[model samples]
Target: MTEQVSAASNAAVDTISRAGWGAELRATFALAWPLVIAQLAQNALHTTDVIMLGRLGPAYLAAGTLATTFLNAFLLGSIGVVGAVAPLVAQARGARDIKAVRRVVRQGCWAAIIISVVMIPLLLQIKPIYLALGQDPLATDMAEQFIQIAAWSMFPALGIIAFRSFLSAYDATRAILVITVLGVLINALIAYTLIFGHFGFPRLELRGAAIATLTTNFIMLGMMVAYVLRHRRLKRFNVLVRFWKPDWPRLREIFRIGLPIGLTVLAEVGLFTAAALLMGRLGTDEVAAHAVALQLASMAFMVPLGLGVAATVRVGIAFGRGDIDGVGNAGWTAFVLGLGFMAVSCTLFLTAGTFLVSLFLDMNEPTNANAIGLAITFLMVAGIFQLVDGAQVVAAHSLRGLSDTKVPMLVAIVGYWAVGLPISYVLGFVFNWRGVGIWLGLAAGLAAVAVVLVARFAMRERLGLMRSRA
Candidate 1:
């Protein structure tokens, strides 16, 4: 018995030691690189899908764009609801509350499942809405089929995200990297085989892409579940069993914190999706150009997105530890790093905008001349926004670290809807400025969000520090 107690005590100490870095630059990088790699892998799969679909036909390309928009607007928001798990789990780690940590994760997974079930039907209903919105019939039909198939994967994908959030909050980022890499690889292989009719499989076209993504999600979910089951740390919780024990109070707490963030995410996505609609009205080439520009911008955003995730973990842990200075320092570290990266991206795009745009589109075709022109203009606009985009995401994440979400939603509504969407519509249609005008509106909105979120974080940090002192 004494020997067993000694072993258990050693294990507890090890877990605590692994919970965080020492607030040093090197230590921060050591914690952050894995997250960056995971984000890169995820982005690579998205880029690959676009490249492959672009090769198929213009209809396929357009369908992919529309389908992706629906996925982000609907299913992605639901998953964001579970994103509340991260800071809470990280804080629990900081406070050494193992039971609370496990409970948060388990309830989060349950919430994700419920969310996925709700989202699947909403995605199915989007087809009629697309038709109602006057999307080109062929494009709308292809997008509907793709969304229907892809929406089914939300359950598994979100389950994977829930587990990933659990592991990452404990600073086990390597597991996330491993799982995401495997999923991306599987997606690539399956997408290639099915899309091209390889290995005696029938060519499934757009459906193949959807199936590949779906299969990859299932594989990721299984891998995460298996990891949790076999891992020593989670074995105590009997995660398979414990994950189902619904804690109503914790669920309410999670909803209180998460719903606003989810809505804020939805609101931002709604703005961009609405911009896509406005672009669609401009013409086919312009819409395609908009899609290409958005894709590249998304790729660029991954760096800041990963940094934001790291910032949330670091800030939450620091807050839990009552280290006000450490929280502010971590936020600064992530923000500076993200801004520096965006500066590099801006320079690269400015120098090679045409060349970069050409890579994703067929510039040699006369049909693409308008697209090429529009894409370059949009890329230029995106270059300006990337700076503010990075800053705002980091700022919003800093607020997440303080477990604040409500004010950000209000900021998103005003910044994106009240300001950005109206400006986009006017410049694109009324002023006839086209895609560039719409993009300028997006930049303005992002700048607004950046300023507001930064101020909000500063205020919250002061209050949190005061409370800690008290």
Candidate 2:
């Protein structure tokens, strides 16, 4: 482990020398840690849902997992639209263009609201789709109910993301962090009380979890809206200034950049969601295992995701400032941090995967043993792709900062769907590798994406396109 750390440190030092030291690590970390904590808190909130559902037995876990998987495939994919806020606002902030920042945030929020409205109907239809796909009728029915209740949360969730992106771009991450902590606490308490019928609440099971999540979404959005409206500096952006103004050109620009990001996110998330659905076809136990392993992977992924957020800001700012060296430094530094962090995660997954997966299952429940067993297998394959997953995500976000979305989107389509999905289907079904094969396919896809994405960013730098265009 020490030697691994030494090698990772040496690699970072080497990257710093080549990339130059203009993008400050200290500044980046300062901006990044709070964001990381907030992301962990959010994932922890979601994992809490998994843990709570898991305790109810594999049926409950499988049902909730399947439903959320479907909803997230759409919800997160659309969120790619709100993601435009960070880079758009950061670049505007870099140029100290107050009007541009305000316009972007307000317009971005409008975009989120519009996207949320469209997502609701899609979520409402999850059950029929599940049935059409031949999922267990009982599980499909329960999942459908869950999505119906959960669908309402998307409106506020989208709003929160938009505002959160705006705040993150400005380095005002702490307020968002505090609210997220409160949200997790709220979600945990509400989920527990309602799930177990504690504190005189109804034991609505899956419905209770959705209600808790939805309730948190509303409150979090309220807090975000309030914060933006009241915070001295944030208020200066006038995010809430005019609710009905039309900025046709700016909205078009945002959609132009954001649509590809949305598709890219959709493509990647669609792969995993497809994997989850495929696991369901195998059995409840398979789905349960896949859910557990994916949740852990997601938790670990927050580090890179947060770094990616920071990279978007730092690199976007550098781009706006016309700092060629800073763009290289920011992007490379984030890649180093993200990959190095995931290296530690890979070690943990490799060394203690059984124990980690065990936390999501009840060892005493004999029925859950299957899930635990399958999850252990998946974690090993998950560990294999940790570095590459980090590589792709970090590099992708850096490109996003360059406002380079379309090509990256194309790269993702080819990498995840073209390469990853086909391979997963072949290995899992064709070769009969089953659970393990599905994960291997994911690893392969991510590895391909990592190679191509990093190379793409490198080429952009070499050609001076990122700097010259900015």
Cα error, candidate 2, residue 7 (Å): 20
**What tens-digit string does per-residue lDDT give for candidate 2 at 389-426?**
99899999999999999988999999999999999999
lDDT of 2: 0.87
Best by lDDT: 2
Model 2 weakest 10-residue run by lDDT: 1-10
CA RMSD of all predictions: 8.7, 3.5
> How many clashes show up in model 2?
0
lDDT of 1 by residue, 1-470 (tens): 34433543343234233423244345556667898888888877777778788777666887888888888898667766888988888788778788788788888888888898788888988778888998888888888878878889888877877787787777778888998899888999999988778999999888888899889889989988898888887666565674567899888877888898889889889999999888777777777888888989988888888888888888888878877666666776777778889998888767789998888888787777877888898898899888889988887887787787888989989999998988888887789887888998999889888877766565553445326522
* Per-model lDDT: 0.80, 0.87
